[model samples]
Target chain A: MSAQSAKHMIAKNIGVLGAGQLGRMLALAGYPLGNTFTFLDTTGNPSAGIGEVIVDPENQHLAAFLDKVDVVTYEFEHLPVELVKQIEQHKPVYPGSRAIAVCQNRVEEKTLFDRLGIPTPAYRVVESAEQLAAAAAELGCPVVAKSVTEGYDGKGQAVLKAPEQAQEAWDSIGHTQLIVEAFVDFVREVSMIAVRGRDGEVVFYPMAENQHVGGILRYSVAPLPDLDPSVQQTADSYIRALLDELDYVGVLALELFQTRDGSLLANEMAPRVHNSGHWTMDGAATSQFENHLRAVQGLPLGATNAIAPTCMVNVIGLEGDNAALLAIADTHLHRYDKAERPGRKLAHVNVVASSHAELLEKVRACQALIPDAPPVEWSFESTL
Target chain B: MSAQSAKHMIAKNIGVLGAGQLGRMLALAGYPLGNTFTFLDTTGNPSAGIGEVIVDPENQHLAAFLDKVDVVTYEFEHLPVELVKQIEQHKPVYPGSRAIAVCQNRVEEKTLFDRLGIPTPAYRVVESAEQLAAAAAELGCPVVAKSVTEGYDGKGQAVLKAPEQAQEAWDSIGHTQLIVEAFVDFVREVSMIAVRGRDGEVVFYPMAENQHVGGILRYSVAPLPDLDPSVQQTADSYIRALLDELDYVGVLALELFQTRDGSLLANEMAPRVHNSGHWTMDGAATSQFENHLRAVQGLPLGATNAIAPTCMVNVIGLEGDNAALLAIADTHLHRYDKAERPGRKLAHVNVVASSHAELLEKVRACQALIPDAPPVEWSFESTL
Candidate 1:
């Protein structure tokens, strides 16, 4: 279709189910494109600073909020699928409830990956302590046990070092439906952000190598320096299969484990804009937040090519001087207005440079100003 | 001082006096930096679609709005000086009331240019029909007569083609305080945007060559192709002197007329972000809007380097398919969400390219989508 016709079809008002940093960034990205946002959160504080926030507890005010928007999408993937289904009855919700339902359950997510021939660790479902022990024995002595639902940020999961610990792990998790998998020996963790539009157009951002501390992402570097092409290709094929299977119409983030032999194994997926893609705000031709809005709004997707080498470091529980962060040359600081709390993401800094070395230097300079931030030295070398 | 100390001093909220496209753009830029905006206008529709707008009629409710923000600034330059002075009593206003007071009148503005050694077209103040005739005779025929206050976008001004038209021009303008000046026979119109920080740091963006139709700006091409270094240096010197003189703490724009002999003549000045600088949103490393916020908040200034050759075309009185404009590659569209009128500025399209030739191609492509837009072409070649 011509650009003119496509733009006339642009959604005037977009709705997000959750109001957080992702929703705030989405509103910020959509503002330039002439889209207003109405967010439905438990409280008004989620996106209160950026857009209109409607408090809708028990889905009582959902219909009224939906009436004000043309389309609906969610920020966090853990929203109740039934609530999204209720919204879908009134208006279209991008990445639909099926994708959200599958991602909410570890077993369902792994089963979909298996059906699509995506590479993943060996896994088996367990319902009770006896089943958990058997599954751990079958997978091997060391395995990761994850609950079927409501798991995130290293929560609702446990690692079993031996068969003897299987019962203990299951008991600790309250014996919910679980998936036990043989842990992969990975060299590093990386993620790729893919956007699939309503017209079936798909674009993938370069993989971002990530670092996590205590299950929370601490930093990420895009275009994963010295990454093997075959590894990226493998990850892309899996993302494509998932998008096709789910009929996805927004950004889908796939996290993978890069093994020592440069092979990729799917770890998980996020049905919305992911933290690893934050660097795109400064380093890419278009940001993931903007592209996500385009996909959900059914507009033409923007360029996803990286414009520079970039690194993003999350500011967790921040109480330092923001002026110090803004002082670094070429460093873009994003501070979410949420109150600071331990282990909560308060802000992030994206350092962009014409070259990887310069980006690293600036990233290190930014890291020095924030307390408790991890050191800024990368283990990989640039191959580009 | 260390960045930490500087960040600790960052302002929490900002207020804009007028909620138009300029204020909307400023809010978009400041959003990522964790700043919230409260706008005060005659009605809510001006900045209604974006930030919170407080209706303050007759400056009766100005103090209540001022109490909600940390610092205050404005979008339009023609705001009443007395009203701004009243707000200044409670909270700080960037670019201050003094700059606004001078720029609101043509005579005071030209006087400042003269005192700062900035070359301007030869002009004389006119208070009556007799003085108007004398000034036109002294400056020769074909002079421009402009009302000293409340004139913008070609309004409140008239050109006297012959001595006989002097009385007619004076009567047409309603005999307001005016300035009659020798008409500049220049090669082209250009403008420079300079941002001054609270710490006395000043940075100038590359000059933009502007095209105006009936006094409303139609398009702008940045880095002003084939611009002489000395001309740029002269413009910079003038901006620096003005910044120092006004103790300016935000973005200030100086529009100039380039002569056939490569000399520059000052035309006028704006105390806030100018329309010509809109291209910086997609073309520069840091947009003028963001820099203006940084200046007001007392944060370190961002980079002012151009990332590519860029051109911006205003979508005046638009009533067409926005999709066509968005379809152009590397084109950034900003719609102000205002009701379209016969000649109102509804939106703008920014086209960025690696080469000037490519930029013109995309700019032309965008122009073709908007109804009644002027043809796109650059008469000058790049000197860099």
Candidate 2:
């Protein structure tokens, strides 16, 4: 398209709602494409420490900021709803506030899924201690208790292996509103990603199996061939239904559980680019970062095919020999410049290959070089 | 490696010989891996104008510039050997002065190749107008005449379809020093990329099929499967012989010709990262750019296995919308930041994929979205 054709949609700058690694990566990706990135953070956050960091949402001319750029997008779902609403007054904020609201609350997300005829773990809203006791009785003793709002990477969520741990989990959440879900007896945890444009066109990347540990993503592998076709379809349906209901207008991730019975259940939805989609950087035709940019910019989505069976391993907080890790062949490591602390999201590497097995071998090789990492576990939940 | 380990290497901040796109990219890639980049171009040639554009290489160094960094490497072959020798007293140079001496001139490179028993196109010395005439007659009517000391990208070279074009070619070259070679009827081009650390262990990447247009590199596809095993062996032998002959270090590109006789003939070599290796950025085990830095730093050479079947297309003098091209998925365009003009290397986009044919389709699609570029014809000399 010519500049004249793009003049209608071209905003002078983009106001990314959350200035974290995702936003920083988006900024990096967009900057070279000649797009200006204005970051939104709590002002003191490291993401804002480098780029055009904006803290205050009020008393600023939203019009001027919107006027300078095209549209607004966020890297994380934790952006304030009021700020999102305020930004909407001036320009479109996508995946819109509704998507954020639904994705932000596990209860609301499950309720939406249930209403949309999408399969989710048997879940119930827990209002208080008494409600949790009754809900767990119905759901099961080993059920998971999660705060209805604002939880990610295993925070504000706990497993009730026994009734003794329920109070601890409840007290840990400060008795906040929570959702009790029957733990899935799934064989594999996987995710499906899609980019939804304003015109309602959606492009889905090949499904990927995710492995998580300690509520943290440890690795993600694509074209999850072990996944049953029915499960894959069900996962795709759940994601599309959620996006359709929320009117999502960017890349969204649907975390799913492929049960032992071959049934796929919706676990959660992320409104923005999710960690599971990081493999797209080297594996798929479009990276989640670039696709999010294109989706929010109202551009045509590119091909959503995996060029290879890809594995993305998060370089969680380890100050290993940087040269050693980087010297690995065909391994692309992306450092977020985060301080290396135990369990911190420091950097990530995407390994691409012709097959999932080869990618796993690469992941193993690369992970071996990453010093101080937790021992490589072949767990289903933990993924990087 | 720590500062203590790096200390023994006599950390010399590299003074790149040329300030062009290669230098600019070399700087961008080198610095992040822990080396500082200083260029020789004055007033910052617009191509190398991306980051901390070093405008006066000499005065800038004494102005406490060299204090911050260690070691030096050249981006191109034609870096004045004398200037490099002058800088040698201050910082160590990789690929060394010997590499420059051998690669900068066609006569010298040919002599070295012949001495090493490498097969090349039939040729003879053409120093003067009379020499050009005699050489053409001996070689045949249709020949390629190139200045022995300076020629590249079809510049300083001409094709003689008949003897009449010889005098014009000589005049075009100013009849200073030239070599006329019998133009071989080759089918395609391929290149072998290898990196040698100070220890002399050569790590080679899978050979790539090179496709060129208008004498400028347009695309390179890796893992050229059609190559005969014997020819591939010969190519490796040829590179090994050249590196040994030059006592070379760092990443080097060996372009070859796949003649009708099914033999690989010597074309030329780039002592630094060549355009054919751009796919390595996202497609290789270790990028040529990073490996070059590693080799220059006296570090271990990396594995050269390709992660994907990748194709790279150069965006030359684009008149279309930058945002349009930038929005495309899987597109990595490296703009030199030079003022867009007719026939200048502006930017290049690498489309990485698993299937060779699929990557070509995307390249064509991207080429359509970007500005008009003349169809680059692939001769037997692009990668070969």
Candidate 3:
């Protein structure tokens, strides 16, 4: 190649399927690498707040969006699989339609996990309250029933304390099909995020132990002090199997449960960058957003090494004092520019420190600055 | 205080005076902080590809630009001081008109240095060829003559090896007034970048040793391994004095010459975020761009600690292979989206590593990928 062509980046206009915080961050990371973005927002309310937006509620602008972008990727997997498949014929879509189809269905995702020999909470698919009650009876009471589709962020879900409550749970979910899963006595919730490049190259970030309050992720810290190397390896292998089986490209996040015996059960997987990896923005050698962009762009994957012990605190619903939150040392805030709304992911603050103890201290201090921020909680903090 | 107000970043439409790479980067860093930007391009040709640009070649849209923004900051200091002063009446301009006035004139800048007790190369100001020759004879045989105003990147500058070359140098420069100084026999050129908050809180980054070829910076590396803590302190004090004296409310970059005895002589100061500090984008806890925006917006400054050893390579005149450059591990490319031309800075590559040896190796590998990149050289490299 001539030197001129070699030195210049082949600037690509990436077509993003969903316009949310994930896509906003992808564009933010992509721009520095000489890429442009054209977002195709299926929802009428698009919150990317930056970049070019094509609000095609009826898919009227699909052809126009395809014409502008070199490659396509979705920020949220809730996108219609047929739309993704159609776009694939026109442009290359990372992770492809199969990953999305499986991820969108609870039964399909669990079946894939079983086929791949990945362990998960015992689950049974049911189309009626009678079957749900039978499944709850077989699995044990206090089971969780979730809609087979369109479920996310603890939405479309209900807990049945007994077989008698199964009818109420089914009525509450209001879905024709449901997956009733027996609750696992896991000690903590954790997630592993990995990225696979176009060339089938894969890199994994350190496992992050997560804290969820009211079914929303409140905090995540990576390079867990209490996590065994073997436990991390098992999580890596499980995700790697999924990535290879689906011929995936871009970042894939697998949410898992770490049990008292140091075993992990796969809870679910996201075909795009996950919120648990947001700490990588300031804590890792390369952020998950940048890695996702690089993977979809067919560039080499960057190192996923952690730079420090870091915590990511999600700012949900309400905003906090901008000055006070920032005053805490090593705090980096990323605001989504959305107005205050209940349960909305408005922003997140990533705090980095030399040690995990110092990190916890700062995180608690930061938590105090945000009004009504969930009380700072971490499974490892007690051990520390 | 209400939690809602505290959690929100009061979004501001920043009015930038120049639309160059620096302005482009400032906007890139500012966006995640939930800020917007409008560039007021005084020059007909502006290179900031992102953000809103008001091309006011005749200053006709000055009022419109001012009206759109809450506060103003300039990327390039060569702007007309009177224009900044006029804008100050309507809105705040950080680093103010006084900073621009002193930075635009060599005499005023050197006078400020003298008043603040900062050491500098012996110099004399002259208005005629005879006076220039007299200054050269008084300082020594070999002297450097620079234009009093409007010179940057080695432009409007001439080096005299002998006193007799003054007339030819004078005609070559074509400037009516010039400052001639005896060249200091320095070991190496270094720079200190510091940010002063609106309340006068100052923080300094570890000094970066810079390499220049034909007056354009080619490479810069920070947290020099061979540097003593005391030297860094001295450099910090020098810049702190300047920041306090000017009442600077943004990032200030000071270039200095380190003599054999480890003493530093002030070369010049730029009243804005500078090229040498670009390494902070990937290597520091808080990037210079973000700190500059924070200071101007009246927010607390983020930490300035270096994450690791880092090097920044400038892409000048020609482009290199993007894939090859990025293929280097831990390497990041920031392209300005500009067409390449002779002496034009098109992009930069930031290579970071845990140790100086590893950093040097990666930087060398990165340098080889660029078509016409200068040799990777650092004074501390030999020590490593």
Candidate 4:
């Protein structure tokens, strides 16, 4: 090829389905590679701080947006599978529509995990009040009934503590397909961010121990200090299997539960960059957002080595105090340009240090700067 | 104050005089802090890939653009000082008009250096052919004659080797005001990037050794290897004096020459984020771009510690081979998304390593990937 065409070939225009913080970060990372982005979001103001946002809520103009870009990816998994499939016909949609379709529905996700021999909590599909009662009896008390789709951040889910509450749970969520899962007594919640390249190369970031309040992630510590090497191996193997099965090409976040016996059970998976991997932006040699863009663009994967111990605290629903946040030494603050609302993921703070103690100290100082910040549990033992 | 007012106060809209790579990187670094940028450039397409660009060549709508931003700064030193003065009336122009005016004129810049007791080469202003001959005779042969204004990257300058060449040099650039300086027989070129806060706190990044071809910088290695601490101290003191003299706020780069006797002489200074300090993007705890924004916004300065040894290679007027560039492990590639032209800076490669030897190896590998790249001289003996 002539040099001019070759140069033009290297420059790509990528389209994103959502303009949230993930898309914003993706643009931030991808722009350095000389890549341009066009975002399709319901809101014209996408968290992608800089990009042309096409507001097409009903996906009526997906083709118009698709025609302007060479490849397509989404910031969130909740985008309708059919929309992705339609875009795929015009241009390549990375991570594939099948992966999004499966991950968007709890039943399909769990079934795929089972098929791949990955361990997960026992679950039964519940279609009606009778099925809910039966599944509750089989799974025992305190079984969690989750909507198969359209559920996120503790939404569209309820716990049935007794048989008497089964009908109430069914009445609330039975309008959609559901899955009743046996509540495993997990000791710690952790997640691993893995990426698969177009050429089938797979890599995983170090595991991050997570703490959630009201089902919203509050903070995460990467590499999950003192983690059993075998658990990491198991998580890697399971994610590898999923990547190969879905023929995925982008960042995939696998959430898992560590039970009392030291065994791991799959919780769920995100088809895009995960909140837990946010620490990579400040702590790792390569951030998850950058890696996702690299993988989708078919570039070589970067080193995922952790540069230091890091803690990522989400600034959920609280606004202001930006000046105070900038005062903390060595703390990297990322504010998503989104309107603040209770329970909304507004921004995040990354505190990195040479030691775990120093990291915890800085994290505390950062929290103190924001008076309304949610409590960040510092469980040192998990990182011992 | 209520939290809402405090939050609104933190959100700042910054305007830049030139939308070049420096401004682009500044916008990139500042965006994560929730700061937005509006760039004013003659070119409709600016390197600031992600910000609102206002293309106003005649300055007729300057007030309209200034009305949209809270503060203003410039990317390059060549901008008209009068324009900056006009903007200062509407909003704060960082580094102020005095700094820009002095730095833009070689006569004023060298005068200030002498007044501050900083070591610099002996020179004479040449406004006529007779003055050029007299200055060359006084300074001896091989003197450099440079335009007092609008000179950069080897342009608007000529080196006169013999007395007979003075007439030709004068005839070539006699229309503009010029300064003729005795060229020092220097052993090395080094630079220091320093930042001063609004609160009067000062910090400096480690010195960087630079290599230039045709007066255009080709590469720079940070920390200057085994540079003498005293030399660093001297550079720091001189820069601090300049900062205090100008009441400077934001990043300033001081370029100096290291003679064989180890004495340092000031060459020039850039009153904004500089090319020599680009390695900070990957090597330093806080990049120079981010620190510039911090200083201008009155935010606390970040740590200036170098995380590792780093080398920055400028990609001047070259394109393609992006895949080959990304193939190198741990190499950070920054493409400015500009149309390629001879002598234009289209991109840069930052290679970081744990040790200087390893860094050299990676830098060599990076050079190999770009066939037309300028040679990078790795002087181990100087570093040692």
Candidate 5:
């Protein structure tokens, strides 16, 4: 769909912030639309090929890449805010600074959630050691003390046994900005993905339950099993309210905690399309990559129905022969062409089936196809 | 899936016979599969870089190109059998030359059908003007007289309104080998796609009612409405019977006519994937393209169930701008990447919906998006 942009920047390309797999996939999806998209990266990542990735632009040349594109979007955060601000001056950045600023820090995201009246766990922003102790006193022991900024994949999150552990939590996170959050009694960790168009339309995909191992996301299944419809409503409401408050554009992902009382608590938000939404590429009517591109271009949002109850399992680098994984039945293997490094996300396989049990069986069958994949121990319990 | 062979051809590369959109799409599909799939074009043609299209291989030095690849396959028939035989001495040609020879001509295919006790229209082989006259007398008026070999897209076949039109029919076809057949009073036309793996396993996609205009396919809808289960069974039997008889490998599309009384008659066959089966790309659990690749590679056939009752419409080049076609809502537009010359097969769009009416609505919406596209008229009787 063509975007109705003003003549001023209609000829401009798009500047993508991060050059990771999402950027590569986005660039691939955008390539069909022609030379409308380009990416500028701070890292010399290999997947950044749809367009040029400016590793480090000089002060004068910095605006050249941003100037070439009409708008800016990002694939990942962790880039300095000052770089984003510099580009924002020359072009518009969707899921703009406010969203990314909040997303960069747990404390800021929670405060933004609280102010927006979104359902989130009770928490306090901690500064000094006294403030950490005070916040813990208000909450309780066994709480989560996490670095407010730049923490991902269970990093910087520490469990406090008492006031003694609180100092270590901030210290473990490099003693940057920190948050002392009350631990919610949760039954499951789930995520919701939605795209907000430039026209202010918010479209949500089916809620999916995310399972992680070693702090890295292992798999995600859509239409979370035995889910209450209310969870969808709450998730949609929370996303819409938050997006509207930020006037967000492009895709957003919300990490949610389903509490014992069946209440959904907001954990954090991602400004760009998240890994949990990757199944939508094969399983949904429109992939998150395509939908995000559409939304940012001011085009119509695509249908978000799950392709089926699909389970997506990520392959963290192959320790042995890659041939076994390639042999998976009817398998659509998406291996990122990045250099193989241990613990690096190599590829993901989406197993689509009619039912959950069948999906599990398919996953196991696929796992068998990949030699030396970590054994999947499947079980469920109600902490409530 | 790896193809086990006397020589692992994919170990080097592979050459495709035709450089049309089918070859182009196949090339795109194979990009992630690790092997560089190239093309051998009768004429140099640009087809989305499936690989380099080598024309005039004899003059260009076939050894140089052939040395670069191992196995060979064609995207479509119309390739000369001698060339295929020549290629076979070096690399295997899928769908085999014997199968192509039988399927490419009407006389051989019809004789094969008759031998298998496969039901088809009454017919007689025609050699000359005298033979045409006699065959017309035998088959009666309003019969079809046509050349046997290398005729497609309703070319060469002519309706004989009277005994005198037989000569004109023969003249129009420039007859080499020909057939005259009684025309069946069928209400609609349908095509079934079946794939045969190297192991001789066969899997069939559901019957699709095809709508054509000017001898070109306009649209095809799957899960043919009100079709008897036995009819599908008959169609499958027709496919399997042919598959076994020819020792066919890769995809075969059979065009069938259902007489007013509900009897099935084999009209013609395509040795490779046909336009009528394009709906399988997004409509089926696995695409016909991917399945053909699998079948030819000795991999297990993918499940062929219709994921959603789907409708596919061909996007023929129109008088005006084709750029707007990219905006079609809920439409998957595949531009051939061919420089559009008016009336050429420019592209096709496949739309999937939960119901027939929704599909029609989506089609209309798509038509609106392609303002420059030729006017699309829907058949009210389209089965979905």
Candidate 6:
């Protein structure tokens, strides 16, 4: 794992945007590769507890940051596209500015998906309540209306059972523009993570079945036992297309709906490492964080194959008893060092085992130790 | 994963003595467990390169270091015993001060091995050249004479091929006290690492066959294919006795030599993590670094079972082309962020595979890419 692109590798100062858990993990992975990190915190509330952070609430320290780092990569996608574009002038930015631009707006993301022939739920961009109702009528009932920009998790989203509720949904989601999508009746939600190096080499991890509670990911299990090889190939092809189209130089996660017809419909994609791929930390041959750093550093990507049947159980709000959780076999705890609060992601537990049954058992044992953890359930359980 | 012994886990500030690569890795492993680090560097030059370093050239910042940390641990065993003893009064130190005291003096270490009924090479502690010659004559030719107080990595030591060379060996060692031991005719060298928790429970890793060049560890392969199950049991029992005897609560490594008759002889032991156990980072279920932190933090020790056949190649003196090395499948690089110099350990690569045959193939491929790497050879290759 080289830190810089040279005949002989040398330590590089990696500039990171957004000081959150993802940045913290990136620094942890990058440090072993002989790289240092300097985080640019825009909100002045950096949670990536480790590393040197620059509080740049007004973006006045951009020149200082650009002068210190050899390359720049972001951990969070919500950063202003202009900020990333400006940094690109002084230092190389992985995933580029187009990635941030498209990911910031759902309409742009969907348009690219449509142009690239990646199937997505029927959708239309609307700016007013009347247009939202019209789009709902055209797409049919049970549509999800979301603000095109500045929406994550379940924020700024509303479900309209009928076109008559469009006005109420529009009022609830306080945004200038919205993307109304017809809800797909799917069997389960799944995501595939891929990394594309600077040399245009791409690698994909096995699809992970996701279980979300209140739109926040609760659990993710990789190498789904019931997943057909064709389905995996389809996912790989979909993400490969996205990676190449964006010329992505880091990890990209594509979330999809696995319908009963044995087809995948693209739901959304994240330009950076996604929560659904955290299971790779212990389950895959190389973690997503490490692969992301490798790609950003212009190094060859690592093996993406799953090492075993693994599950990631998110510890949200309240944390579990650390000693009790670690006492469980094959459980690895990763704490964010953030104080406990309702609806906050405090930590996650990675459970790995030789078989899916054993993995589920360990996951259940792990979940029992977490305080206020959602019930452990997976769509592949019945197949197993 | 708990940082303290309380019912609920909390982020702890860990105090580490000796800021070196071991301490850097300990902090890397500890950060995920939701702990912060503060290092006490007795030497002005600290190679840790990370963490909050308190350089106390005259022991002026001991109070500040102690004030910020909850529990204390040492990465190097050669620290001043009185400094550790003083730190013990303010904070709990894992492995205790007695472990350091015994490890610092070769005579004390050998005597403890004898008291614990651990077999060792024939040896005699000598104070003068005349006594050294008598001990060499008694023990036989080709005896190793090492300074009793300070000797490591073939330093402060000399080999006397004949009794008449005792004066030369004594003069070379430059110490008032020396321990002379007869060399053993062994099949090969091997080591076993074990971690003991605060509860007095012990877990041992599978024996790793080690290869050394100029007394510095060059390579180590774990879960030796030809090793008898009884041999592993013997090594485990030996380390377990040592751990309990010293009331040790951290990772301890014991080097041993396996004779042609399939018996193990105790060579020496390290109070902290050893170079031979670095393979555990990728090969075992739990790494030695994480286990050491867990033990020091009063948490339960993790599983020490090897996940696959693994080999660790030390990057000494020079570094390999990072891109070429990482191009190999299942190869993991961990650099210490140090400038390359003669006889310096810059980094290491961990190669893993499902079977020993495949692992050997990969290890050979990985070695070819490293600059100045020794030829790849393994004791288990013939068995494979």
Best by lDDT: 3
What docking class should model 5 receive?
A: incorrect
lDDT of 3 at A367: 89
How far off is residue B214 in model 6, in Å? Answer: 0.5
Ranking by lDDT: 3, 6, 1, 4, 5, 2
Highest DockQ: give the candidate number.
3
lDDT of 3 by residue, B73-189 (tens): 999999888888999999999989999999999999999999999999999999999999899989997899999999898899999888799999999999999999889999899
Question: Model 1, stretches more than 4 Å misplaced?
Answer: A1-9, A43-48, A137-141, A228-231, A381-384, B1-9, B43-45, B381-384
lDDT of 2 at A193: 94
Clashes of each: 7, 36, 11, 1, 2, 0
lDDT (10s digit) by residue, model 2, range B1-384: 766333323233566656787876675555434344666555345356433445664555433434433677767677678866766677677888888877888898888888988888999987777778888888897888888776778888888887767778889887488888898888888888888888787887778778777787767777764567787778888898888767788988999988777788889988888988888876776678878877887766666777667767777665445456545555665556555687777777777655656665666677776566544333422333
User: lDDT per residue, candidate 5, B198-266, as tens digits?
Assistant: 889898999998887778887788866578899999999988999998888889999988888777899
Q: CA shift at B384, candidate 1, in angstroms?
A: 12
DockQ (Cα-based) per candidate?
0.55, 0.23, 0.72, 0.58, 0.18, 0.60
Query: Which portions of model 3 miss their true places by more than 4 Å?
Result: A1-11, B1-11
lDDT for position B275 in model 6: 87
TM-score of each model, paired residue for residue: 0.95, 0.83, 0.98, 0.96, 0.85, 0.97
Candidate 4 runs further than 4 Å off: A1-8, A43-45, A381-384, B1-4, B43-45, B381-384
Candidate 4, clashing residue pairs? A24-A48
lDDT per residue for candidate 6 within B1-384, as digits (tens), equals 444335555439988898989999898888889999999998897888777999988879889899999999988898778878988998899879999999999999999999999999999999999999999999998899999987789999899999999888888888999999999998889998999999998889999999998898889998898988998998998999999999999999999999889999999999998889899888888899999998888787787888889999999888777888888888889999888789999899999888999988988888777777888777667878
Per-residue lDDT over A210-300 for candidate 5, one digit per residue giving the tens place of the 0 to 100 score: 8887778878878666777887998899999888988999999999988777788998888998889988866887778877877787766
Cα lDDT of model 4 overall? 0.85
**Candidate 4 A-chain TM?**
0.95
The DockQ-based order of candidates, best leading, equals: 3, 6, 4, 1, 2, 5
Interface Cα RMSD, each model: 2.3, 4.8, 1.7, 2.3, 6.3, 2.4
Calculate model 2's interface RMSD in Å. Answer: 4.8
Q: Of the true interface contacts, what fraction does each candidate have?
A: 0.62, 0.15, 0.75, 0.61, 0.06, 0.62
- Error (Å) of candidate 2 at residue A308 is 4.1
Q: Which 10-residue window of candidate 4 chain B scores lowest in summed lDDT?
A: B2-11
